[model samples]
Target chain A: MTDVRVIEIKKSVFADNNEDAARLRSELKGRGTYLLNLMSSPGSGKTTTLIQLINRIKDKIKVAVMEADIDSDVDAIKIKDATGIESIQLHTGGMCHLDAEMTRQGLDNVSLDGTDLVILENVGNLVCPAEFDTGAVRNAMILSVPEGHDKPLKYPLMFSVCDLVIVNKIDVMPYFDFDLDKCSEYVHMRNPKARIIPICAKTGEGVDAVADWLLEEVYNWKH
Target chain B: MHELGIVFYIIRDVKQAAQENGVEHVNAVVMNIGEVSTIVPEYLTDCWRWAADKEEMLKGCELKINIIPAVTTCGDCGREYETVKYGKTCPHCNSANTWLLKGNEVEIKEIEV
Candidate 1:
């Protein structure tokens, strides 16, 4: 005798996560808060830049953070110290990239009822983070002066998907021979529509421009 | 190293496909991989051996990757060619104005049950 058992499993690898991200996107939009998913390699000054940005825009914009870290809460602590704004650290444990599910889980822990912005500091990796969108309306790519200018080509996906390119750590441009023009050219080549902003996260250079851009993005979104 | 993640996705997808087709076990899975995607096929298969070995639905499943040409289309010349040579500049026109046409694909194509 032959027996037949029929089981139905409808799933995409990231379907559940993507659904969660979609819901978060809607929730953030409803709360009148803009979301930015920040991505970069380790030591690319994403955190430092965030601190600098908070110094300038904290009073003007209500900001929150969803920090993705593999192990430590050091970055979350630093962001809180810099801005005094409440941030929820989403610890990935072993995950290299923060998927939509984790970000939504982090959102559940945040009080976004009256926030103006939520910046998700993605795990320090240039590749996978681009593939998995966390439902953030915008993604910012930070390429530090020390990481060289050829990053856009090698990590094209990350740069191509980014709405903004932050050339961080530009204060030390005198010491390192980083080709600002070449970096922007590459960024433009990959994505002609992307905005490239150069800033020094540590020295507070060109931060207001970034804040201005954020204001513009937020204003544009609301209308 | 991230190939492990891709493999898990593959295993998960194949199991679903197999179940939907009412198949007891999946025999093989075929994927269309772009040359420029960060995923390494060899590493993906290597990770698959361990992750899918114990699953009854995925045991002995074969993984196949279809290579997609890494073509970049020049804005000026309007020509496309395989520029898998690593650099972004177009080899034909020597123009950095080209955009990627393919080679960044990462998708499952087919599965045999």
Candidate 2:
């Protein structure tokens, strides 16, 4: 029998990705580009909300978008056609989430010149995407009315990591059993500092607050 | 699906380690998966068997998992408890201000050659 040797290598698998995220954040800061990572479940109206917010802030701030999905460029094409801005599609090659390196590659494909903000629509996954940081200046998620208000308790990590939680489909809240007050309370239970904004993306109700929040964030990031 | 991505990361790290140590043909790779890390061991091993075999050096290599139990510490009560059982609340003091002390790790422990 041949002699067997053991090589010790105790290190977190997320360490490299975390380091890369930090480096990418600093680089984006130097370039005066604010990156926002938007995450949610599939069919959470991410595209509609983006279209609403982008139309409000595009003239004031040079905005671009990176839509990440496992396959298809439908989201990218939709955003470009609706908002008429620079938008690119990133296929994760069957991966459920986008890591820092993937976010960097997507940024490279977009022209960052004269661009103040780049919003990355991450893969529609609450679990895997929260585990990997995409080097975004801030992380936000949209929770629709039909998904129920107890999601914060179910997915604590996703709620805790996000800086903002957009409660979309408020128009249908009366039809569904989603309680806005209870939802806010649960969200606070996970993260006290998280800002919750309720809006109906289809009717453009309460969308100005989201636009204002993004504008303020982009301004603060640049200055 | 998530485990497959993690398996790729493990393969990359192992390959780099082998290159640095001037070694070839890793026999087994050991991983420390925490209880609350959201990784299923069976899926991870399945992905490992599929992906690792595709690599020349890691072909026929075994992926061994060591599960670490999750523990949480309460800030109000100043006590530790099982994370999976009590979750974010401290069972001792019934305080919601508890944080995870351990068991969120997804680390590579070692490699046998």
Q: How far does residue A99 in candidate 1 sit from its true spot (Å)?
A: 2.0
**lDDT tens readout by residue for model 2, A1-223:** 8898999999899988999999999999999999999999999999999999999999999999999999999999999999999999999999999999999999999999889999999999989999999999999999999999999999999999999999999999889989999999899978999999999999999999999999999999999
TM-score result, candidate 2: 0.98
Q: Candidate 1 on A8-65: residue-level lDDT in tens?
A: 3323345555677788788778778888899999999888888888777878778898
Backbone clash tally for model 1? Answer: 0
lDDT (Cα, tens digit) per residue for candidate 1, span B1-113? 46776676777777767766768887677778888878888888888888888898888877777878788788878888776873567777788787788877777777765
**Candidates' lDDT values, in order?**
0.81, 0.95
- Share of true Cα-Cα contacts across chains kept by each model: 0.12, 0.84
Q: Each model's TM-score?
A: 0.89, 0.98
Worst 10 residues of 2 chain B by lDDT: B85-94
